[model samples]
Target: MQLGTFSFVTKLAGFEYTKFVRYDDEGDLRVIKAENAGPHGFKTTNYSRVRSSSVAELTRSRLHGGELLMVFVGAGTGNVATVPEGKDFFLGPNIGMMRVETDTVSPRFVELFLRSSVGKALATAAMKAVAQPSLSMGTIRQIPVLLPPAEEQQEILRLVEQALTAAAECGADVREQQSSADILRQSILAAAFRGELA
Candidate 1:
């Protein structure tokens, strides 16, 4: 199903708020900017501190679980990824979060589409670079979406989740093997230095 810009979807779904919810820059809340996002997703290694004064700022664009967070209005504009579950986080000025109206659109389906080549092309086209390439809410709202049936969306999400879980497990295994290799290398080096290899 061909759907017009994001605004159309929001309006169709009766999303009452058009404004993004802004969070306060305070407490131990981790502020994730465009820079903190890796190609895969949100990078947590380094984060900025939220100021007490900046707390309570709400953006209708506030990210929650199952939302697709796109890096709009920033240097990293066009970078898109889904926010993983269980992470209470907020986006800075450089990012925009799209909350899919579950009744009308599947967040998982949107996430998959955004990661697709077609979505990438749309993003590239929408992005404007003067000093910094940034995407405005209007630009985002203008991008078209293929709206699949609700059941199809749910099935797609389940498949995607399963695949992601498998991929993560594979990554963990690789890391374990790498760690073992490192340990073995260190042991061999020590043994050789002690003339055990001779």
Candidate 2:
């Protein structure tokens, strides 16, 4: 199913409509703006919250888990993310959210697809701009989604995540090994210069 076939909404721009409030102490509403959602993905630790004070804000701007977030405008034109679990965030400017309404469509799969090279290419092709690049809600709603069955989607997501984790671990190991090798080389040079190689 197309992503927006479920439900979609852009972040509101009513400054006056929002009450200046922070969840830093009370922990109610958290705002995930475009800046918080980078091209890499959404980070759980950025800790930026909404500008709304009244609980009525939840009636519209509330973001549930498992929605695919996309950077619809500006420099981050193609950035996408699956909202992490444990907390819900309020969507902010230059961002779009597609909350999957059916068990048939996997949100994780959609997020990964949008981040893939093919998906990025499609988004770039649809992009239009004068000063800043942007993808209209229509463009996103019509995105050609590859729907494997739910089980296949889960398996693919699991395997891809595992592979990515292994790759990251290998990279860290390589960096650590290289750093030790550099130190050893420097030590060998210092010993030779001091005629301690004997």
Candidate 3:
């Protein structure tokens, strides 16, 4: 079955920020926008909040957790993230949320594919070539997905996780090296000021 075939996939409707959005410091529902969804994952620390009352009107936008979020509009278009379970997040403008109803197809697997080079190319090709490139829900549904065996899919996910963990560690190492270099430069500057270098 294709993505939009309702039998296996459920596409959540996104609400326009200007029309239904009312940011409240006390709001319990956080809006996950394009910026919130990135390569690494959804950034939970900082995001706009909408009143629960406003969200009650648009129940479809409320994330049920495990939904694959895709940014469909603007420069950050095609960015994807998996909504963490137990988080109260609402779909913001320029983004779309999709939920896989069947346990046979893992949402994470779909997310990984969507972030892959092949998936990105497919999405890019499907996008409307306007000044602001965008992918409609219809276009998204039309995009083909290859289904590997369940065991194979699991193996692929495990490998991706391992690679991501290594990448994160490497990033940390780079940052540490940069910090050490900065400290060494400062120490050298301080020694020069004190006339320690003969």
Each model's total of backbone clashes: 20, 0, 0
Give the C-alpha miss distance for residue 195 in model 2, angstroms: 7.3
Report how far off residue 40 is in candidate 2 (Å): 2.8
TM-score for each candidate, following the candidate numbering: 0.70, 0.80, 0.88
Candidate 1: RMSD to truth: 5.8
Candidate ordering by lDDT (highest first):
3, 2, 1
* Sequence-dependent TM-score of model 3: 0.88
Who wins the lDDT comparison? Answer: 3
In candidate 1, stretches whose alpha carbon ends up further than 4 angstroms from where it belongs are 1-32, 45-66, 82-91, 129-131
At residue 195, candidate 1 shows an lDDT of 94
Q: How high a TM-score does candidate 1 get?
A: 0.70
Q: Which stretches in model 3 have alpha-carbon errors above 4 Å?
A: 6-19
Q: Residue 26 error for model 3, in Å?
A: 1.6
Please state every model's RMSD to the true fold in angstroms: 5.8, 3.1, 2.5
Q: Candidate 2: worst 10 consecutive residues by lDDT?
A: 16-25
Candidate 2: pairs in clash: none
Give one digit per residue, the lDDT tens place, for model 2 in 1-198.
555675564554557235533445455667777765676677666666553454444455677777778888888887988787877677666777777778777777887877889877876677885689988888888777777888999999999899889999999999999999999999999999999998
lDDT of every predicted structure (CA atoms): 0.62, 0.74, 0.77
